[model samples]
Target chain A: MSTQIPKNLKYTKEHEWILIEGDTATVGITDFAQSALGDIVFCETPEVGTELAQGKTFGVVESIKSVSDLYSPVSGTVIEKNSDVEGSPEKINSNAYESWLIKVKVKNPGEISQLMTAEAYDQFCQTSA
Target chain B: MTLRTSLYQKHVDLKAKIVDFAGWDMPVQYTSVKDETLAVRKKVGVFDVSHMGEFFAEGPDAIKFIDSLVTNDIASAAMGKAIYSPLCRENGTVVDDLIVYKLAEQKLLICVNASNIQKDFEWMNAHAGKYDVRFTNKSEHYSLLALQGPESEGILKKFIPNLPSLEYYSVWESGQTIIARTGYTGEDGFEIFGSHEYIGKLWDQLIAAGVTPCGLASRDVLRLEVCYPLYGHELNDEITPLDAALAWTVKLNKTSFIGKTALTDYKPKYKLVKLLVEKAIPREGYHVVDENDGVIGVVTSGTMSVVLNQGVAFARISSDKFSKGQNYFIDIRQKKYPATLVTKPFVQGGHK
Candidate 1:
């Protein structure tokens, strides 16, 4: 299956994607994560104002068959939590890139440089598969 | 090394996700687990269950010999009828649950769980010394395909147009093929047991006819929703039939079975109960706690119910420590999620 990796986004090895806008970063799982997890039934995201550490678990995404931990790509504090995805987790399965889970104010800008580019992420997924 | 089924290539051709199941490389999903689950609930789905074990018993004393081993009275089961029973050890604990199909007065077929194939065969064979009977392990020679859901009968009619409707738990045999109106998904379905060559052809025909191919992940969700007992999850050597809410399957009055003496007065210390959790999902090994947060049980099997859009589980709780009117909660990740006790079969299907 071909996964969507937006050209404008940066990715983590854990399959999370981030779209930077100024100092804030919008975070969500990649298309590969959603398809791999199957139909997501429940999503638990950290509330706004919650602090996040880079590569640390901040949320959980549960599908019918399995549960996955959502890791933060960059250390920051959660400024927005997507209640829309919380109410309807299936949205992530439908359009993962569009269903952003959180928005964070970047704690350390250096972490952004450590993440993967779209092309690199595509290659990573291929090698892993 | 893991074993592969005859249809392993076919599953790969269909782009199925393979997983190691009981030492066998089996398909866990073709599309998505939820989609395949709904297909079986609302439409038709085909499943490859050839990993299950099959044993045949043939002799002039077949009925009596088989009847002496199981808890159920298979001697009374009419020809072409299938009987479900538990093979128990001397201590009244279950070894394996199997289906006994009486083909004739001198012949019968026994189907068991995949993981328990060798154990079940050895247990049965060791006890068959005195009876004039012959047993053969024929699991590798056959393939089992289950056509399940509300649309199953309609789709099967396209293949066997002239065949009559089979009653529940009834088998229709023609040569080496046996089609039984039996399934684990609680749906109006038929389990077709035949040679691998015939099953492979039928699988292609069904797929060409647009029937969805389901896998083990969906099968687990479907069976759990219907409150069916899985072998390793709900049943084990330590669990008795009474503990698993399968008392009806144990006919204690039958003319002296293996566990008759022990099961005659058996009272289970633990009882399995169904729970409905709307907020959080409970998984295996999760603790079941009471209102005071005291642990009282453990979850055996659980999943997100697609039909109810909630979490459902089977928990084995201490019989004396829990009450029907009291509040129960499942401890998931150190958080207590309230659980409501529900009746058998969290979802009803089209089956009788």
Candidate 2:
């Protein structure tokens, strides 16, 4: 709950955040998610041009002790994938927002309404915690 | 509520993430498992292994009584030396694997896993009816600290100056304190045992000397990299030492031991093998398959190695199904990832 929840971004219940710019959106895990997962050692993200469906697993993030599925928050085509984060996953631990995992071209803008705002996401995290 | 060790408050002060391990509220990691693990491999790190159980076997028949219950030649083991053995059941399955320190001919100290304390005590007492040995569960009276890594000796020498003379798997007594050159991390280090008050003081001293405080998470990664066996993971009540590829710990030539008769006729069903996994990181309970995707075994322990920068695991492959130079795959979440069966010790250790 103490982690930052930037107001301009949209959030998913799985703790992924979205930064919408025009018709494309940059996606990454929230600071809260990164902290909860501990030290991430490996990240497997969908390659560019791969189709992603909302609420489905597009990849995985592995910590030293556990592995978590990375859920795609919005349905779209993967335009760009962060290879730096894949090679050095600890960047997500240092700054999850800045270490965006993928950039997707929006397929359905209606899914954006289903995503929670920063305040709503904060309340969700508190209740789940 | 879980049990807490004497250093619980210290771990809290260091902001360690706590988890219930073997019924104890133990620290799993402080900063990260990767950092703590690397610190022990490169520098020095201290672990609060006080939750481990300790027992005392002392009497005129202590050596004979203890030797009869385990699968090692404890009776012939020299004084001041420690012998690792598997306490086996009558059927040759392991009851628990423990380290027995031969302090004197009539006095020995036994250390068991924390979760197996009660079960091991009951098992030992049931078998000690004929021998004149007195078994004392002294687990509550002791606290153990493992100071490990390449720089461990230099740091620990600050307190115990005579630490240089202690040989590996040997115990040195200093009044009521016991310092043994033994650790699970595969790093050259010492395991210090003493009362709660004395151990608390020693912990503070080691921390002040700039030793990294490690947790159970790093400890597992370190041990697995060295191919050391853990009770619940690589070993269990239903698995014999031979089945787990711990035949070295079983002295078959010994005249008489608990499971000697059964173990002599034992045929291995499972061959514990190490794997260097590709693609996905394998976890416990993951099925291991052959080229045709036929399930052959299950992974007991798996982790992403900080040193190797890859996923590594230990799996119990069916002996009849396994063949030398044959290919293997680990099935993870409906996907089969290619796994190469590798030799032991996934990482080179610093042990002397």
User: Which predicted model would earn the best DockQ?
Assistant: 1
lDDT of 1 by residue, B257-338 (tens): 8888888888797889999999988888999999899999999999999889999999999988877688899998788999
What lDDT would candidate 2 get against the real structure?
A: 0.92
**Which candidate achieves the best lDDT against the true structure?**
2
Among these predicted structures, which one has the highest TM-score? 1
The candidate 2 chain B region of ten consecutive residues with least summed lDDT is B159-168
Off by over 4 Å in 1: none
DockQ of each: 0.84, 0.76
**Candidate 2 per-residue lDDT over residues B277-346, each given as its tens digit:** 8666888999999999999999999999889988899999999998999999999878889998888589
Chain A of candidate 2 compared with the true chain A, TM-score: 0.98
Root-mean-square deviation of candidate 2: 1.7
lDDT of 1 at B236: 95
